[model samples]
Target: MSPEEKPGGPPPPPPQAGRCRGARPQQQQQQPRRGGLLSEIRTAIRSEPFHLRYRLSPGRELGRGKFAVVKKCIQKDTEKEFAAKFMRKRRKGQDCRMEIIHEIAVLELAQCNPWVINLHEVYETATEMILVLEYAAGGEIFDQCVAEREEAFKEKDVKRLMKQILEGVSFLHRNNVVHLDLKPQNILLTSKSPLGDIKIVDFGLSRIMKSSEELREIMGTPEYVAPEILSYDPISTATDMWSIGVLAYVMLTGISPFLGDDKQETFLNISQMNVSYSGEDFDLISESAVDFIKTLLVKKPEDRATAEECLQHPWLEQSDEPISRAWNESAGGESSDVTQQDADSASEKSVDAEKTEEDESIVTEELIVVASYTLGQCRQSEKEKATEQKAISKRFKFEEPLLQEIPGEFIY
Candidate 1:
């Protein structure tokens, strides 16, 4: 079988015209792959082009965030379109060099991940940093669900998305990069359709860390922040898993499970780990779906399922083969953790009926917001809180309202 025929891999390009057909088809030799693709990537990095190679289109803004704007640009000779992300070099009188460099390093490390945004080249102006990225015509997945107009997405679509997300995050973990902020808004699509490939974006809040290191900064959106983050505990890869659980909940229920009317209430919910998959909406979802979500939302970071484990769950597989809750600890627990495809292994362990109860935690329709969550009435004066929140309302500077997912052709 040809290399291109390997299961799940993309097909090879068609033969070019005027190219020698070589000998008879039966005598043609299959091309050998050497040094994998890492060597090729290293070569590309050595000769990456500069800003002068591209012609910026007439100031057509594609998207915008707090301190940057993404524009659509075209190559000078090839006219190939690419996304040029321009981030300011300074913010709040502080030099943004460290943060920008960290982000770039993380992106570079994650370049080999297909589901991760591909960074083509980098450039700099006196006051800005420009990243030439593979353009994802599809907007944020949050907006995609809104365009459906029904609030939530179907389980099948969720399966595809979850697979890509797990694969991408697993890749990050393997590279020691932690995406501190992962939400529906940060997940993008390659096109404006359900079938558009998944593209995780916005690494401004991401960090690269060694396995033994941990970060304690309070980061990420209140609604999706992990319980540990709220408690000011050390951050790890599992911290990102918590946000993945919340993201799954939002995609499945069209509701922000932890979002409250105010910041205090939201933080209270997260701190308490107040999450549930109850209610009528969950009735139609398979039991496996709840298992996948619950395993990632654990209060103990160590207990949360790794990205490798999430890929093994039945919900993401969506296979007709008889699914088993039994796991092969020896085999399943060992992996490079680079991608779902590389991490998966069929378990030979038989289900132990004694452990069945462990799988039946919660799967209901009406997800109840934990009322026992501790934060009481606002301790600070309402006026002071209001003043602090005034600037936050303008935090996400998108070209259009965030949740308005209009799926028409994305006119460049």
Candidate 2:
């Protein structure tokens, strides 16, 4: 398989392209003299006649997707490295220049935020646009998810990473933007050995939410998609929270909560809110972490925890100290001090249990809505099948008489 087609590995270096002649002095004018998609793109991105290769040295391909390939590039002047993403203006014979422009706009909107990947510059060619973006050398956090047991992240590490993710997401929500796609693959790290900070990338599926408008689209990775998305409900900031919940689950257990054998089954699992906290997968995990996941995985978008709330959760707010072992060691015998601490812990547990029960009740109520929605879908599918069957029957009946009218030898 080609390097671009290969999955889950460091991409090889991209081949060098031919250099073009420099733009004339008159053509170097910064004004958007041209009209159409180029003009629209110029409104958000600075377009220059000079080629990107003129100022930057292209290196290895960092990653590749459906319509874009990111390659490592170094600035000739500053010697700084950047990820240059090359995106096609057209996909499947359809003009999608506007979609690329929208992504540029979203990046520009969140440019000031440090957690989101920064866009350095943009260059346009005849058929493709190149975006020089801040390079995150650590690669995707997804690698850690599937890493060997010894290389997996501890609970405290998960807390730190989650906190940064929540901060970035909160910034986006505050700006009235929703990153429809929030998965491990889109999240990058600045360093790998010490585990650097999170840099959320890929705004290709993000959208700006307006109070006067309702945005709805069936987009995003199926494993991380929310119930509202499957139901065709209006999109909101809560949509991103659901993905965060799924992300947290994966980081904690290295397993997806609602994934099934196939896409249809996976969709059904998400639509029906089919998730579990089995002991096998979550036994070593803390209760606070489980509670945080439960809070955000609610089927009702309105009930899911927001980014701000998630940041404030006890799990994320826990101290960075080593995991405590006093409670576990006390299994043999308890001193007066340990006994008192146990009483206090039990009291806190009681309160937490009460809150958990309330949350469970709320989820139970939401399950009714989910069941109704699923039933309606099944009914619709049955109706469509019956209608198709009737059409086929009518056609067969009409054709049977025509066959009878023909000679037996001709029919044979």
Choose the strongest candidate by lDDT: 2
Spell out the clash pairs found in candidate 2.
13-60
Q: Per-residue lDDT for 241-299 in model 1, tens only? A: 99999888766655566765567767787778766677533545568888888998888
Give me the overall lDDT of model 2.
Answer: 0.62
Off by over 4 Å in 2: 1-60, 324-412
Model 2: per-residue lDDT, tens digit, 120-209?
A: 788877888888889899987776664544456667788999988987887777656688778777888999999899899887666666
Instruction: Give the CA lDDT, 0 to 100, for residue 398 in model 1.
Output: 18
Whole-model lDDT per candidate: 0.58, 0.62
Cα error, candidate 2, residue 316 (Å): 1.1
RMSD of 1: 17.4
